[model samples]
Target: MPKEIKNHICEEETFTGIYSKYSKSLHDFLYYKFGEYLDPNDKMQEAFIKLWENCKKVPPSSARAFLFKVAGNMMLNDIKHRKVVLRYIQTKPKEYTNESPEFIMEEAQFFDKYQKALSKLPEEQRITFLLSKADKKPHKEIAEMLGVTRRVVDSRVYNASLKLKAELEEFNKFYAKKPSKLL
Candidate 1:
Protein backbone atom coordinates (compact mmCIF):
# COMPACT_ATOMS: atom_id res chain seq x y z
CA MET A 1 0.00 0.00 0.00
CA PRO A 2 2.36 2.65 -1.27
CA LYS A 3 1.09 6.21 -1.24
CA GLU A 4 1.84 6.71 -4.91
CA ILE A 5 -0.15 3.66 -5.85
CA LYS A 6 -2.95 4.73 -3.59
CA ASN A 7 -2.92 8.21 -5.17
CA HIS A 8 -2.70 6.80 -8.75
CA ILE A 9 0.12 9.32 -9.36
CA CYS A 10 3.78 8.89 -8.62
CA GLU A 11 4.63 9.85 -5.12
CA GLU A 12 8.12 9.11 -3.80
CA GLU A 13 6.84 6.04 -1.98
CA THR A 14 4.97 4.72 -5.02
CA PHE A 15 7.95 5.31 -7.25
CA THR A 16 10.22 3.45 -4.88
CA GLY A 17 7.81 0.53 -4.65
CA ILE A 18 7.41 0.33 -8.40
CA TYR A 19 11.14 0.58 -8.96
CA SER A 20 11.85 -2.15 -6.46
CA LYS A 21 9.30 -4.39 -8.08
CA TYR A 22 10.14 -3.92 -11.75
CA SER A 23 13.63 -2.43 -12.24
CA LYS A 24 15.49 -5.73 -12.52
CA SER A 25 13.07 -7.27 -14.99
CA LEU A 26 13.06 -4.12 -17.06
CA HIS A 27 16.85 -4.01 -17.11
CA ASP A 28 17.10 -7.67 -18.12
CA PHE A 29 14.57 -7.14 -20.90
CA LEU A 30 16.48 -4.15 -22.30
CA TYR A 31 19.79 -5.99 -22.10
CA TYR A 32 18.35 -9.02 -23.85
CA LYS A 33 16.82 -6.87 -26.54
CA PHE A 34 19.75 -4.52 -27.22
CA GLY A 35 22.72 -6.62 -26.09
CA GLU A 36 25.95 -4.75 -25.30
CA TYR A 37 25.08 -1.73 -27.41
CA LEU A 38 23.18 -0.09 -24.57
CA ASP A 39 23.60 0.37 -20.85
CA PRO A 40 20.53 -1.33 -19.40
CA ASN A 41 20.88 0.15 -15.96
CA ASP A 42 21.04 3.68 -17.33
CA LYS A 43 18.06 3.11 -19.56
CA MET A 44 16.13 1.57 -16.69
CA GLN A 45 16.86 4.56 -14.51
CA GLU A 46 15.82 6.94 -17.25
CA ALA A 47 12.53 5.09 -17.66
CA PHE A 48 11.81 5.40 -13.95
CA ILE A 49 12.69 9.08 -13.99
CA LYS A 50 10.31 9.55 -16.88
CA LEU A 51 7.62 7.75 -14.94
CA TRP A 52 8.12 10.05 -11.99
CA GLU A 53 7.98 13.08 -14.25
CA ASN A 54 4.63 12.01 -15.71
CA CYS A 55 3.14 10.37 -12.70
CA LYS A 56 -0.08 12.29 -12.95
CA LYS A 57 -0.72 10.96 -16.43
CA VAL A 58 0.30 7.36 -15.73
CA PRO A 59 -1.67 5.17 -13.40
CA PRO A 60 -0.12 2.51 -11.17
CA SER A 61 -1.69 -0.28 -13.23
CA SER A 62 -0.20 1.03 -16.49
CA ALA A 63 3.19 1.97 -15.08
CA ARG A 64 4.94 -1.24 -16.10
CA ALA A 65 3.93 -0.92 -19.72
CA PHE A 66 4.74 2.76 -19.73
CA LEU A 67 8.21 2.19 -18.38
CA PHE A 68 8.93 -0.50 -20.96
CA LYS A 69 7.65 1.64 -23.78
CA VAL A 70 9.78 4.56 -22.68
CA ALA A 71 12.86 2.43 -22.34
CA GLY A 72 12.35 0.79 -25.72
CA ASN A 73 11.94 4.13 -27.40
CA MET A 74 15.10 5.38 -25.74
CA MET A 75 17.03 2.32 -26.88
CA LEU A 76 15.80 2.79 -30.43
CA ASN A 77 16.90 6.42 -30.39
CA ASP A 78 20.31 5.39 -29.13
CA ILE A 79 20.66 2.80 -31.86
CA LYS A 80 19.78 5.35 -34.49
CA HIS A 81 22.32 7.79 -33.08
CA ARG A 82 24.99 5.08 -33.01
CA LYS A 83 24.37 4.26 -36.65
CA VAL A 84 24.87 7.87 -37.59
CA VAL A 85 28.11 8.05 -35.67
CA LEU A 86 29.46 4.86 -37.19
CA ARG A 87 28.56 6.03 -40.66
CA TYR A 88 30.38 9.27 -40.05
CA ILE A 89 33.42 7.45 -38.81
CA GLN A 90 33.48 5.16 -41.81
CA THR A 91 33.20 8.01 -44.30
CA LYS A 92 35.69 10.25 -42.57
CA PRO A 93 39.12 10.43 -44.22
CA LYS A 94 42.11 9.33 -42.21
CA GLU A 95 45.37 11.28 -42.20
CA TYR A 96 48.39 9.07 -41.83
CA THR A 97 51.58 10.97 -42.56
CA ASN A 98 54.07 8.19 -41.85
CA GLU A 99 52.60 5.39 -43.96
CA SER A 100 53.59 4.95 -47.62
CA PRO A 101 50.91 5.71 -50.21
CA GLU A 102 50.97 2.10 -51.43
CA PHE A 103 50.53 0.76 -47.93
CA ILE A 104 47.63 3.07 -47.20
CA MET A 105 45.93 2.17 -50.48
CA GLU A 106 46.36 -1.54 -49.82
CA GLU A 107 45.00 -1.23 -46.32
CA ALA A 108 41.96 0.65 -47.54
CA GLN A 109 41.35 -1.94 -50.24
CA PHE A 110 41.54 -4.76 -47.76
CA PHE A 111 39.06 -3.04 -45.46
CA ASP A 112 36.71 -2.45 -48.35
CA LYS A 113 36.85 -6.12 -49.25
CA TYR A 114 36.29 -7.12 -45.66
CA GLN A 115 33.24 -4.88 -45.36
CA LYS A 116 31.82 -6.31 -48.57
CA ALA A 117 32.34 -9.84 -47.31
CA LEU A 118 30.65 -9.08 -44.05
CA SER A 119 27.73 -7.47 -45.85
CA LYS A 120 27.31 -10.55 -48.02
CA LEU A 121 26.88 -12.87 -45.08
CA PRO A 122 23.42 -14.04 -44.06
CA GLU A 123 21.86 -11.52 -41.68
CA GLU A 124 21.65 -13.75 -38.62
CA GLN A 125 25.17 -15.06 -38.99
CA ARG A 126 26.57 -11.61 -39.54
CA ILE A 127 24.78 -10.20 -36.51
CA THR A 128 25.91 -13.02 -34.26
CA PHE A 129 29.46 -12.77 -35.49
CA LEU A 130 29.60 -9.01 -35.00
CA LEU A 131 28.14 -9.33 -31.52
CA SER A 132 30.70 -11.94 -30.57
CA LYS A 133 33.69 -10.41 -32.31
CA ALA A 134 33.11 -6.66 -32.47
CA ASP A 135 31.27 -6.30 -29.18
CA LYS A 136 33.11 -9.14 -27.48
CA LYS A 137 29.97 -10.66 -26.05
CA PRO A 138 30.10 -14.20 -24.71
CA HIS A 139 28.13 -17.03 -26.36
CA LYS A 140 25.83 -17.49 -23.39
CA GLU A 141 25.11 -13.77 -23.13
CA ILE A 142 24.45 -13.51 -26.85
CA ALA A 143 22.10 -16.47 -26.65
CA GLU A 144 20.14 -14.83 -23.86
CA MET A 145 19.99 -11.55 -25.74
CA LEU A 146 18.86 -13.20 -28.96
CA GLY A 147 16.33 -15.40 -27.18
CA VAL A 148 18.04 -18.41 -28.66
CA THR A 149 19.90 -21.31 -27.12
CA ARG A 150 23.67 -21.22 -26.59
CA ARG A 151 24.11 -23.95 -29.19
CA VAL A 152 22.38 -21.81 -31.80
CA VAL A 153 24.64 -18.88 -31.05
CA ASP A 154 27.65 -21.20 -31.23
CA SER A 155 26.57 -22.57 -34.59
CA ARG A 156 25.97 -19.11 -36.01
CA VAL A 157 29.39 -17.83 -34.93
CA TYR A 158 31.12 -20.92 -36.31
CA ASN A 159 29.34 -20.67 -39.62
CA ALA A 160 30.07 -16.97 -39.88
CA SER A 161 33.76 -17.53 -39.13
CA LEU A 162 34.02 -20.23 -41.79
CA LYS A 163 32.32 -18.08 -44.38
CA LEU A 164 34.39 -14.99 -43.61
CA LYS A 165 37.59 -17.02 -43.65
CA ALA A 166 36.75 -18.45 -47.04
CA GLU A 167 35.91 -15.06 -48.41
CA LEU A 168 39.16 -13.53 -47.15
CA GLU A 169 41.20 -16.46 -48.47
CA GLU A 170 39.68 -16.03 -51.91
CA PHE A 171 40.40 -12.31 -51.83
CA ASN A 172 44.01 -12.97 -50.86
CA LYS A 173 44.48 -15.49 -53.64
CA PHE A 174 43.01 -13.11 -56.22
CA TYR A 175 45.32 -10.32 -55.07
CA ALA A 176 48.35 -12.55 -54.73
CA LYS A 177 48.84 -12.99 -58.46
CA LYS A 178 48.82 -9.23 -59.07
CA PRO A 179 51.86 -6.97 -58.76
CA SER A 180 52.16 -5.09 -55.48
CA LYS A 181 51.87 -1.81 -57.40
CA LEU A 182 48.51 -2.89 -58.82
CA LEU A 183 47.20 -3.76 -55.36
Candidate 2:
Protein backbone atom coordinates (compact mmCIF):
# COMPACT_ATOMS: atom_id res chain seq x y z
CA MET A 1 0.00 0.00 0.00
CA PRO A 2 1.14 3.57 -0.72
CA LYS A 3 2.18 5.59 2.37
CA GLU A 4 -0.43 8.30 1.66
CA ILE A 5 -3.34 5.80 1.52
CA LYS A 6 -2.05 3.85 4.56
CA ASN A 7 -1.97 7.03 6.70
CA HIS A 8 -5.46 8.11 5.52
CA ILE A 9 -7.31 4.74 5.46
CA CYS A 10 -6.42 1.03 5.65
CA GLU A 11 -9.04 0.29 2.94
CA GLU A 12 -11.17 3.02 1.39
CA GLU A 13 -14.52 3.14 3.31
CA THR A 14 -16.56 4.84 0.60
CA PHE A 15 -16.36 7.78 -1.82
CA THR A 16 -17.90 9.88 1.00
CA GLY A 17 -14.63 9.48 2.91
CA ILE A 18 -12.76 11.12 0.03
CA TYR A 19 -15.47 13.79 -0.39
CA SER A 20 -15.61 14.81 3.30
CA LYS A 21 -11.83 15.21 3.39
CA TYR A 22 -11.06 17.25 0.27
CA SER A 23 -14.32 18.66 -1.22
CA LYS A 24 -13.85 22.13 0.29
CA SER A 25 -10.32 22.80 -1.00
CA LEU A 26 -11.18 21.35 -4.42
CA HIS A 27 -14.35 23.47 -4.61
CA ASP A 28 -12.41 26.60 -3.70
CA PHE A 29 -9.82 25.94 -6.40
CA LEU A 30 -12.44 25.42 -9.16
CA TYR A 31 -14.52 28.40 -8.04
CA TYR A 32 -11.50 30.73 -8.02
CA LYS A 33 -10.50 29.75 -11.55
CA PHE A 34 -13.92 29.41 -13.24
CA GLY A 35 -15.94 31.80 -11.04
CA GLU A 36 -19.50 32.15 -12.33
CA TYR A 37 -18.92 29.83 -15.30
CA LEU A 38 -19.71 26.64 -13.37
CA ASP A 39 -21.36 25.46 -10.16
CA PRO A 40 -18.70 24.65 -7.57
CA ASN A 41 -20.88 21.94 -6.05
CA ASP A 42 -21.36 20.13 -9.35
CA LYS A 43 -17.66 20.33 -10.14
CA MET A 44 -16.84 18.92 -6.72
CA GLN A 45 -19.22 16.03 -7.25
CA GLU A 46 -17.76 15.30 -10.68
CA ALA A 47 -14.18 15.44 -9.33
CA PHE A 48 -15.00 12.91 -6.59
CA ILE A 49 -16.60 10.61 -9.16
CA LYS A 50 -13.38 10.65 -11.17
CA LEU A 51 -11.38 9.96 -8.02
CA TRP A 52 -13.64 7.04 -7.14
CA GLU A 53 -13.35 5.56 -10.65
CA ASN A 54 -9.55 5.61 -10.39
CA CYS A 55 -9.41 4.81 -6.66
CA LYS A 56 -7.54 1.51 -6.99
CA LYS A 57 -4.73 3.08 -9.01
CA VAL A 58 -4.68 6.48 -7.24
CA PRO A 59 -2.36 7.14 -4.33
CA PRO A 60 -3.91 9.64 -1.88
CA SER A 61 -0.82 11.87 -2.33
CA SER A 62 -1.67 12.53 -6.01
CA ALA A 63 -5.48 12.60 -5.66
CA ARG A 64 -5.71 16.39 -5.44
CA ALA A 65 -3.95 16.86 -8.79
CA PHE A 66 -6.27 14.30 -10.46
CA LEU A 67 -9.44 16.03 -9.16
CA PHE A 68 -8.17 19.50 -10.21
CA LYS A 69 -7.34 18.30 -13.72
CA VAL A 70 -10.83 16.80 -14.19
CA ALA A 71 -12.54 20.01 -13.03
CA GLY A 72 -10.22 22.31 -15.00
CA ASN A 73 -10.98 20.37 -18.20
CA MET A 74 -14.74 20.65 -17.47
CA MET A 75 -14.42 24.43 -17.09
CA LEU A 76 -12.59 24.77 -20.40
CA ASN A 77 -15.27 22.73 -22.16
CA ASP A 78 -17.98 24.96 -20.60
CA ILE A 79 -16.27 28.11 -21.89
CA LYS A 80 -16.08 26.74 -25.43
CA HIS A 81 -19.72 25.63 -25.26
CA ARG A 82 -20.82 29.09 -24.10
CA LYS A 83 -18.97 30.76 -26.98
CA VAL A 84 -20.73 28.55 -29.53
CA VAL A 85 -24.15 29.21 -27.91
CA LEU A 86 -23.55 32.97 -27.94
CA ARG A 87 -22.57 32.88 -31.63
CA TYR A 88 -25.72 30.92 -32.45
CA ILE A 89 -27.89 33.42 -30.58
CA GLN A 90 -26.26 36.39 -32.34
CA THR A 91 -26.94 34.86 -35.77
CA LYS A 92 -30.62 34.09 -35.10
CA PRO A 93 -33.13 36.06 -37.26
CA LYS A 94 -35.04 39.06 -35.93
CA GLU A 95 -38.70 38.57 -34.97
CA TYR A 96 -41.60 39.68 -37.16
CA THR A 97 -43.36 42.88 -36.02
CA ASN A 98 -46.80 42.32 -34.48
CA GLU A 99 -49.34 45.13 -34.87
CA SER A 100 -53.05 45.71 -35.61
CA PRO A 101 -54.22 46.33 -39.23
CA GLU A 102 -54.99 50.02 -38.57
CA PHE A 103 -51.55 50.47 -36.98
CA ILE A 104 -49.89 48.55 -39.81
CA MET A 105 -51.58 50.64 -42.54
CA GLU A 106 -50.69 53.87 -40.71
CA GLU A 107 -47.09 52.61 -40.45
CA ALA A 108 -47.00 51.65 -44.15
CA GLN A 109 -48.16 55.13 -45.24
CA PHE A 110 -45.74 56.82 -42.83
CA PHE A 111 -42.87 54.58 -43.96
CA ASP A 112 -43.62 55.19 -47.67
CA LYS A 113 -43.49 58.96 -47.14
CA TYR A 114 -40.44 58.61 -44.88
CA GLN A 115 -38.62 56.41 -47.40
CA LYS A 116 -39.21 58.95 -50.17
CA ALA A 117 -37.91 61.77 -47.94
CA LEU A 118 -34.95 59.62 -46.77
CA SER A 119 -33.97 58.89 -50.41
CA LYS A 120 -33.39 62.64 -50.91
CA LEU A 121 -30.78 62.75 -48.09
CA PRO A 122 -27.09 61.71 -48.33
CA GLU A 123 -26.37 58.03 -47.57
CA GLU A 124 -24.48 58.63 -44.31
CA GLN A 125 -27.12 61.05 -43.02
CA ARG A 126 -29.93 58.59 -43.81
CA ILE A 127 -28.18 55.69 -42.09
CA THR A 128 -27.47 57.66 -38.93
CA PHE A 129 -30.99 59.11 -38.79
CA LEU A 130 -32.65 55.70 -39.29
CA LEU A 131 -30.42 53.99 -36.74
CA SER A 132 -30.84 56.67 -34.11
CA LYS A 133 -34.56 57.36 -34.65
CA ALA A 134 -36.13 54.22 -36.16
CA ASP A 135 -33.90 51.61 -34.52
CA LYS A 136 -33.38 53.69 -31.36
CA LYS A 137 -29.69 52.87 -31.02
CA PRO A 138 -27.77 55.17 -28.64
CA HIS A 139 -25.17 57.44 -30.29
CA LYS A 140 -22.19 56.22 -28.22
CA GLU A 141 -23.02 52.53 -28.66
CA ILE A 142 -23.60 53.08 -32.38
CA ALA A 143 -20.26 54.82 -32.68
CA GLU A 144 -18.45 51.93 -30.98
CA MET A 145 -20.39 49.25 -32.89
CA LEU A 146 -19.82 50.96 -36.22
CA GLY A 147 -16.15 51.78 -35.50
CA VAL A 148 -16.78 55.51 -36.05
CA THR A 149 -16.26 58.64 -33.95
CA ARG A 150 -19.11 60.12 -31.90
CA ARG A 151 -18.51 63.43 -33.72
CA VAL A 152 -19.26 61.74 -37.06
CA VAL A 153 -22.49 60.34 -35.60
CA ASP A 154 -23.42 63.82 -34.35
CA SER A 155 -22.71 65.34 -37.78
CA ARG A 156 -24.87 62.79 -39.58
CA VAL A 157 -27.68 63.38 -37.07
CA TYR A 158 -27.55 67.15 -37.66
CA ASN A 159 -27.71 66.85 -41.47
CA ALA A 160 -30.51 64.31 -41.20
CA SER A 161 -32.43 66.64 -38.83
CA LEU A 162 -32.24 69.57 -41.28
CA LYS A 163 -33.40 67.45 -44.24
CA LEU A 164 -36.30 65.97 -42.25
CA LYS A 165 -37.48 69.40 -41.05
CA ALA A 166 -37.61 70.73 -44.61
CA GLU A 167 -39.36 67.62 -45.94
CA LEU A 168 -41.95 67.56 -43.06
CA GLU A 169 -42.76 71.27 -43.56
CA GLU A 170 -43.53 70.59 -47.25
CA PHE A 171 -45.68 67.55 -46.30
CA ASN A 172 -47.66 69.62 -43.77
CA LYS A 173 -48.38 72.27 -46.39
CA PHE A 174 -49.62 69.65 -48.88
CA TYR A 175 -51.90 68.05 -46.25
CA ALA A 176 -53.25 71.40 -45.09
CA LYS A 177 -54.21 72.42 -48.63
CA LYS A 178 -56.45 69.33 -49.06
CA PRO A 179 -60.28 69.54 -48.44
CA SER A 180 -61.54 68.89 -44.87
CA LYS A 181 -62.93 65.41 -44.05
CA LEU A 182 -66.76 64.93 -43.80
CA LEU A 183 -66.47 63.36 -40.29
Best-fitting candidate, measured by TM-score?
1
Give model 1's clash tally.
Answer: 0
Best by lDDT: 1
Query: Taking the tens digit of each residue's C-alpha lDDT, what string does model 2 give over 1-183?
Result: 566655452255645676787899889988888895578779788878777777877767777788889888888888899999999988968676666788667655755675688889988788887788667789997788777999999888888878776876544443343312100
TM-scores of the models, in the given order?
0.47, 0.44
Cα lDDT tens digits for candidate 1, 1-183 = 585447665577777888999999999999999985689889999999999999988988889999999999999999999999999988957655877899678767876887888899999999998888778799999999999999999999999878877988755554454424322
Candidate 1 achieves a global lDDT of 0.84
- CA deviation > 4 Å runs, candidate 2: 1-11, 93-183
**Every candidate's lDDT:** 0.84, 0.73
Tell me the deviation in Å of residue 48 in model 2: 0.6
